[model samples]
Target chain A: MTAAYYAAVDWGTTSFRLWIIAEDGTVLAERRSGEGMTTAAKTGFPAVLEAHLAAVAAPAHLPVIICGMAGAKQGWVEAGYLDTPAALSTIAAGAVAVPDVDRDIRILPGLAQRDLQHPDVMRGEETQLLGAAGNLGDGRHLVCMPGTHSKWVRLEGGKVTGFSTFMTGELFDVISKHSILSHSVADAQVFSGEHPAFLAAVAAACANPALATNLMFGVRAGQLLHGATATDAKATLSGTLIGLEIAGALAAAGAVDSVCLVASGSLGALYRAALASLDLSPRIVDADEAVRAGLSTAAQAIWPL
Target chain B: MTAAYYAAVDWGTTSFRLWIIAEDGTVLAERRSGEGMTTAAKTGFPAVLEAHLAAVAAPAHLPVIICGMAGAKQGWVEAGYLDTPAALSTIAAGAVAVPDVDRDIRILPGLAQRDLQHPDVMRGEETQLLGAAGNLGDGRHLVCMPGTHSKWVRLEGGKVTGFSTFMTGELFDVISKHSILSHSVADAQVFSGEHPAFLAAVAAACANPALATNLMFGVRAGQLLHGATATDAKATLSGTLIGLEIAGALAAAGAVDSVCLVASGSLGALYRAALASLDLSPRIVDADEAVRAGLSTAAQAIWPL
Candidate 1:
């Protein structure tokens, strides 16, 4: 087995992932847990990182590189942010090292767009962008990273010109769990991309983006008047939000030659299907792999083996 | 004091209001409580109504006229709905009488737009619309009644052409209390129409309705980077939702010569200010008086002395 050289960690708000990589860029071991910044802040970031490193059997003196909310003001260390128009490569230089620790540990800084009208920030997704950028030999590209706070970035020749954060995922969670739509979707069965209601809603919202909140209310109205199923209600809600996000992202970004979607699992599938409905096929990149690749790029830049 | 001619009530989802009307259309006595449909459904709607009637010193034999959620399927009696394009004057003919009751108590039916794409229903707002219509006269008019679920109606002559319900107020409540924006607006101070943030947000959302959700996230980003006050965050959230509603309402209406705003108190002021910012000078009508006039109109139609 190749000896592990350095560890790469993505510590998010509510999740933690660590990978022990060999000097030649082969992944030797990996660990994932709920010990993200939120949990780590309470349990001790050092202890959380130590346990994950131990689980992966990482060498005690091995250098470690981290990205995400762990570098936030409320995270493990304040790594700060790189303001736009920011060069993706300069992210490695902004890494804030953890002092007084036995091992060499560094956390990558996030990216911030200070535009007065569209001020936005991304912690971990910037790393994902850095990694995804390498795959697209770019003139201009639109990158979408879908999650709790979905980030839509505009990349011009390897630099982040600007980006917008749509509160799509979080709004879905809150509206589904806390709003009046909760009752409409309580007994919802799991649905997918091909659901008629989902496709219809995507079309409706995309066509009339101004009627978003009205369309959301239609979920309840549909249930009341047309006896719409819980699955239908849920799908409509999901599709409406996703459609609105896509519309907004496209509106913010003018004509672009290529679009890249950096997402993983079910969400990635959902976005791909949503984009297809709009007649655009995005070049897909696994979010997990992109973040790892980003961390790897930062790792190699900071420490040459 | 003139003997009570009839009792008028506006029973909503979370609030209840009762007024004893004299033969000359004067409000002889009034009573208000929190015994709305939700509470009255569990506590007994008849008993709750009796308590309020007693408080207002309403005569036991006096007939009653009611509107709002009290006519909903879950309320005291299912008053059903009058489908659009409906004549506002015909509302009184659709009143459903309370069975096995000593007095002649009739609950006015709501309005339903059964459009396959935009199914919508309004329980109480129809009454407000009926009363406001008298003031609007003959013409193509767009009516905006802002609340938890704001109703935007298109009135051609005296007929209800179509309407849309924007979940603006409810979305604001849920997002402020449940979403991440909650933190940014936690310490918000009370703001008015003149707030710069509020006006700016209104303009931004009106200009780019597709970017509604994106603008929402800016509240948080503004707080983090620009040191935005909690009031600014709250105002921006409020403005974004309202602006989205106005934009959607107008987009759905197509063309209108005049706009009528039927609302009362602070919410009314806010909507007026928001509409004014969009260069729309809506003809204002007191929602409280409008509902009362509607009930009076229905009462005279049902039991003319």
Candidate 2:
């Protein structure tokens, strides 16, 4: 059996994921839980990390590299941000050590854009960007990382020049559950990116991005007038938001040498489709693999694997 | 005492307002209550109407002209929508009378844009438009009626050509209370249009309407980084949403001969500031007076003195 070199943990706002990695960059074991920063803050971050490591049979000597909300001000430690125009390589060097712990544990710092006009921040995504675009001998790259707060980063010459955070995912959630559109999409079933309503909405929003909220109103109005199904309303809502994100991202980034989408699951498919609908096909990278790779890179740098 | 000609009631989703008028168009008495359509639907609508009438000592022969949610499918009578491009005069002709009532009570119908691409409906705003812009001769007019669901209507030659609804107010309420930004704006104080943060946000969103959601995220990021006060965050939010609404409204409206604002109170002031920021000085009309004028016009049309 391969000996574990180190452990990697991606701690988010409401989720926890850990991987026991071998010396040869193999995942020996993995664990996922809902005990993220919010849960760990209450139940003890050290205790939670230890329990997960023990369950995975990770050795005491196995150094752990952490990333994400675990380093937030409200998290385990204040792993402060590295201001923007920041090189991707510095992300690994900026790993913050978890104090007074026996194990060699470190949490990576996030990225912050301090522009008063466009203030923005990202926690786990900076590391993800490092792993996803670290090796690229780039001119310029537009990296889209979708989540509760979808981030669009402008990477020029392997450095994050600036970035914008769109409240797309969060808005989708609140509008669906709390707004008047809730009634329209109350009975929505699982839908894919290829849904006609979704595609149509994407096209509409992309064509006229300024009519975003008006387009959103159409979701509910369509249901009332045309007897549109719940799925149609839900899909339209999803398409319109994703479409707006893409429009904003492109308009903000201007021209890019290449575009990369680092996302997974249903959201990845939707974004992929949204991009494709606009006649742009970005290089897709799996989000999980990117985060794990990021941790591995930072871990190797910190502990000299 | 002058004989009461008719009572004009603007029955909204959660608000009720009744104005007693004499045949000579003189104000007799006015009543405002919380018994809007929602409450009147539960308690008998006729009873609610009667109680208000009795409070003002209105005679049994005093007829009633109702507008807004009272005419909705869920209200007293199902006053169906008149499909656009409908003439403003048609609204009064579209009035549906309440059945099984001794009093001569009629509810004004709303306007519906049945266009597949942009489905929209306006309940009380149609009457407000009629009251505000009913006599505009042979020229196009853009009327903005700001409320919970703000409506921007395009009136051409006294006809309801088309209109768009921006979920600005609803989105603001939901986002402030439900999204992650809630933490940033928890202790927000009441801010007006004159606030610097509000004006700056309006300018930002107007400059790049696509960056709307990004600007929204900036509210939280600004709080996290700059220690922005809750009021600043709240004002920024308000400005961003209103700016997006204005941008979308203008983009969709193409161009018009004149712009009119039919609104009241603080919302009106904020919109006025937003429009002024974009160098637009719309003809301002009080919403209450406009609605009353609309009802008066429709009432005279229905039951001539």
Candidate 3:
């Protein structure tokens, strides 16, 4: 398959990314923009696509694959998700093609939990799973994807068996900025995850797991009573929230011998550190790389010429 | 003591209040400005006093008493609190008199918990406690002050037995605006605490008071599974958090035979309502009225001409 150009789009709530790649998956050009699903209501889907395309010197007929919250209800088009125990073939078949795109475009359907009493959905992480499958050679592995809406997925032989979502990042931001914890957290200490107090906090949350509420109060009480620094309290709040998420996710996913972490950004590293504390040192992989490999897989499945 | 003039000031962190009162504590003339402790850096103590005094029609030697966050560290001057089990005398002794004013000005000292291993401080609420004491009579009662920082104070015979602060409102705002709960909450359904869903949520939180983190996940899960409305979920999250706080506060304050709740806003009323489900029927009193009555008590204490 000697493809002249390949394009992969990682579009989510906050941002959009377009990668112009060769057949070998080496990037030829890349474009990033502020036009994501969150801003898509104002920017419109066609405009978002056009803006990214305009930034890169790519052919009009380049085969394109997209992932992430771009397939959410508020995204460009609602490209639905495959239920748990999903097959790669079924996922590929479920891809919702954009009606009027110039090139061969396949939007990767996300993974969802439909077998349960109530259905939970995802949109873009399936691409990441495919990317992990391509790299890890298809086996039962615990995949941890950490973000604002962190996903813990179980992948077996290139198919997603089950997954759980943690509101870790969102909780961290809220507790630190809006709760009693905020009293001890200044905005300047937003990235203070490495502080010793932070690790102590993480350990505390992971210890009781049920004391998440008390843990938050402890931040304020620690400062008021124990003279814990505002910075330390802030870090503790962050660590506790993340630690709780880790415990919750692990419980939901059941125990696994090995953990394969699909992580991105500094926050993901924080999660990796948290998982490590819980005796689960994950095989870390960058989300960007995974999504790129995922696009490659999806591209191969569609235009295998 | 035939008083020609009277003055009452409700000074807080972010704002200052001055009221030219009658002998009966009727606010004949009142003025409020943004000269709170937050903006006090730009405007000094002298400036704050001058700005509000300038609103008066005449300069008389009227006795004035103030309360609230103005006694905080960054206020005009730190009006330190009286240690409990203390009474009006304790607070009066600590009152800091402001000089160079044409009138007798006394800043009321707030309440501080020095008995506990970890001290808890509260400004302005002491005056409210005085008012509540007057209204409820000298007996054991619980007061729930709801705001960004909600305080549940235990009082017995005009003395504050103990208190605990919960960041319920702030947490609600943060989770509803920043967390996954944000998705399940609409901007419109924030304050309708009487919603059936809100009561159900209160019950759910009360059921496992310790499982707040897991219970929060239930908001998103409930929405996904049961077609729960965003407003309902939002209210549920709010109820759950508040309910947890109630349970925690009740435990911390020790068991009570009866509860007479002194609450101010609709939010406070909602908290009272939530507590009611636990068979704790609280006799709700308006917080603002409590403050007014409390201010009158303070004025009487300072003047006593």
Candidate 4:
């Protein structure tokens, strides 16, 4: 049997996932928790990591590799950022080692596009991009990593030319819970990507990207005037924001040889359906596998097996 | 002293303003309070209005003419809506008198555009439109009533052809308080409409309204990369939303012979500057005077002196 190797971790703002991988790239153990950067910041990152490691019975000296907000300025250690027009391979090379540890530990730096007209930054998603890029062929590719902040990357050859971050997920969340539209979508049930209201809203928002707020208001107006259901209203809000993000993403990219969606679960399915409606078929990549692959890549480079 | 002929009230969602008018339409007394429809709904609209009426020494028999949320289904009484392209003059005639009240009291009906493509509803702004439209010379006029839900009415020959409601103000409020960007703008100070950040953001949003969420994210990126101030972040948020609104309003209205802005106070100044930056010098009409004029128009029609 292959010996247990390094531990790979994806530590987001509010989530933490760990995978103990064998030297042969097999997962020996896995753990997930709500103790992300925010929680770990107060509870202590070293203790949090030890507790999760102990649960999985991992080696005491097992090397660890982390990405995401763990490298944010306010997180464990500020790993900093790599300027745009950066190569994917350089991602692993930019890993910053955490000091005074029993075993080797490193956090990957994020990517930044400092253009005066269009500035943007991404921490964990860059690692996802690094792993997802290997799945894509050469030439120009539009890589979309959707989350609380959806990132649309302009990748050419093997380099990240630039990227844009759309607050689609966050906007949907705030609007659904805090805005006047909250009343309209409060009792919303689970709605699929194929829901008519969702499809229609996606199309309407893309049709007139400028009328986003107007279309959002239509969610409430539709309920009032046409008796649209709470589920439908929720779907509409989600669809409208997603559509606007797609419209802007596509518009900014101009033309791409292929579009790659690096997302997992429900969001992935939703984006696939939305992309299909817009006459584009994206090459789908699982976010979980991609992040793990990314961590493995950095692990291999740091501690050549 | 001129005797009070009728009391005109503009009861909004979160505010209430009243004026005692004489037989010759002279202002006999005025009252303002936070007792809007939301507060009055729970505390009793009649009691709220009676207290204000008594404070102004209003005569026992003085009829009240109200226009706003007081007429909503959830307010004092349901005044319903006048379907479009309804004449502005019909708004006064559509007033629903309060049943069982000793004195004659009526609430004006709101305007509703029932078009399947652009369904919209406006409660109090119809009265403002009725007042502001009179300021226009004729042909075609685009009336902008900025508020929580800014309404842009298309008026042609004194008729409200159609309108669109943008959730601009409310979006600003929710996003400022509920999103990740909230941290970036939490310590923001008062920024004038003339702030460079405001102008730059307005230009950028108008240039690519499709990229609104992206541009909004730029506020944080700008701060991270360029050390932008909290005031600039706040201004950017305001300008971006306003710019997107103006872009959509213009696109929806098409070509109009004249543009009129019916707003008061600081919001009015902000919109004016935003419009001016876009090379639009809209004819200004005070919102306070407009609502009073609208109530008086309905009052004169209901209670002829």
Best by DockQ: 1
lDDT of 4 at A99: 98
- Among all windows of 10 consecutive residues in model 4 chain B, the one with the lowest summed lDDT is B129-138
- The segments of candidate 4 whose C-alpha lies over 4 angstroms from its true place after superposition are none
lDDT, residue A212, candidate 3: 56
Which whole-number lDDT from 0 to 100 does residue B173 have in model 3?
73
Native contacts present in each candidate (fraction)? 0.78, 0.75, 0.17, 0.66
Candidate 4 backbone overlaps, count: 0
Interface RMSD of 1: 0.6
Number of the candidate with higher TM-score, 1 or 3: 1
In angstroms, give how far residue A51 of model 1 lies from its true place: 0.9
Q: How many backbone clashes does candidate 1 have?
A: 0
lDDT of 4 by residue, A1-305 (tens): 78899999999999999999999999999999999999999999999998999999888899999999999999999999999999988988899999998878899999999998888999999889888888897999999999899999999988999899999999999999999899999999988889988988889888888899999998888887888899989999999999999999998998889999999999999998998898989999999999998888888888997
DockQ of 3: 0.18
Q: What lDDT score goes with residue B68 in model 2?
A: 99
Off by over 4 Å in 2: B134-137
**All DockQ scores:** 0.87, 0.83, 0.18, 0.82
Steric clashes per prediction: 0, 0, 5, 0
Tens digits of per-residue lDDT for model 3, B1-305: 33445566777766677777677556677787877777866667766766676667535556777787667666766787776666643566678887776667788887666543334667887777777777666666777777666677888776777766666777777777777677678654555657887787778656655345656766786676567777777777888787777766776677654576677667776877787777777877787677777777777766674
